[model samples]
Target: MENRINNITYDDMKVFFINKVKELKSWPYNGKNVVIAPLPEHVTVNPDKPSMFCFTEINDDYMEFRRSAFWLVSGTVVMAFMISMMSIAYLAIAVCFFYDGSFESTLFLCFFGSFFGLYVLPMAARIAFFIPHDLPVRLNRKTQKVYIASLILHGNIFRLRPELIFQEMDWKYIEGWVLHRSVGKGTPYYGLHLVENKSGDINRLQQACLYRTGAPWSTSEMEYQINNIMSTWSYCQHFMNYLPVPDETEKDKNFVFLSNNWLFKWPEAMDKASRSSG
Candidate 1:
């Protein structure tokens, strides 16, 4: 009885945090205002098609998946370039003035460097102290909750605006879709989002990754994501609904990015939240 009571307490705590996530107003919800329909329940799976195979960790308690780190590294590059621009600009200005260069030339250098850097400052400041190496999400099967790390960014710009929000949400309230688009297709105009906190009066959906540009038209050599997302979604849905999860042991061994390295342990709070029931 005592053990059961403790489990109940932990479950309640999970619910509490799921509610708390809705209070976070800093999440960049721009361009994700439209509502897209949830994926069809009975989409066909191609046996030869690629699996998104993005699992990082899986266990009796929960399974975790981290978004690809490509954008995170890109953000780091942008941050470095921002600093370099400012430093180079101001350095040139000082050197020019000290050497008795023309006043007009010095002024031009001053404005050029400062303007470019200052333009990058807000973007730099968004990522600020910590560079998010990855966005990890933990799905707890028992509690039916999701703890996710979401990064804010768009296009070539990195706006780590919410600075890596770790949000907990009930599975029922969360919706997800893998979208593909082109400039000829659409960018922000294509994605969908809705989030309200209470009473069904407001949106209660978990908001993350609001600005997916989808499969671009640029004739990428890789297979399109729409082909893979459905399978991945099916895998996650089986785990959540207590159905028989499709076995991907053979597939997982072949083409998945395993994030079990010591370097990529989740944040302490999220680690705890995801493991609370397990």
Candidate 2:
């Protein structure tokens, strides 16, 4: 009746992930070949943290999703903030040197000016142009609701607005697409997107990425890459379509949900919804 995560040991998780990797390797695809059968991406592949797919929880009733490069955004924010302070310090230092001649003020100038080698990029000056927090999405099977944070209403920075929270949608109406974005990195990385149509200036809502290219890559990287997304979608499809009375309840869960960020944040929003059987 109640499932709680307690005393889950490292070896227990390692074995669980090992089995998951094996499952992905075998991946019972129903099509003409093994390439087409959608397989679930294993949760928490790394020993340190759940990195590649950015999933933290992959239970039978719900899956939590996270953004890629968690630290990049975090580091960027911190870096931008520090830069902002330093930028102000620039003026402050000028003020202290010309006006106060205080020892601490002079020391402050020497310390940071030398630390930055006399220059800091104007990151904070344009901090307004960046998203404030990492976007996280959730997929709940029981209540069949998808809760998305940071659902983009507008991509343009000039007219940026609030990042909406508590945007819930019926799971049945959601759609999945394998999309690609290029950063001029020569090869573009493809990932899975779960989306729904919105009846406003913004056409789509709950656009979240849950899969990235992972091991057992095909002979041609592109084919396997596409297959990866297809397989991820298939995994979600299976998870949602086939409700299992888990042999082990918490342990017997299947299907990585179409979502993002295995985070410390998704639970508060998704917990009540996922616990239900509606």
Candidate 1 lDDT over residue span 149-169, tens digit each: 654344444333434456677
Task: Report the lDDT tens digits of candidate 2 across residue range 161-219.
Answer: 32434467776666554434342233344555454534321313334445544322344
> How do all models score by TM-score?
0.56, 0.46
Which residue ranges in model 1 land beyond 4 Å of their true spot? 1-35, 41-51, 68-130, 153-162, 177-199, 210-223, 244-267
Candidate 2 least-lDDT 10 residues? 27-36
Best by lDDT: 1
> What are the lDDT figures for the candidates, one per model?
0.47, 0.43
Q: What does each candidate score in C-alpha RMSD?
A: 10.0, 15.8
How does model 1 fare in lDDT? 0.47
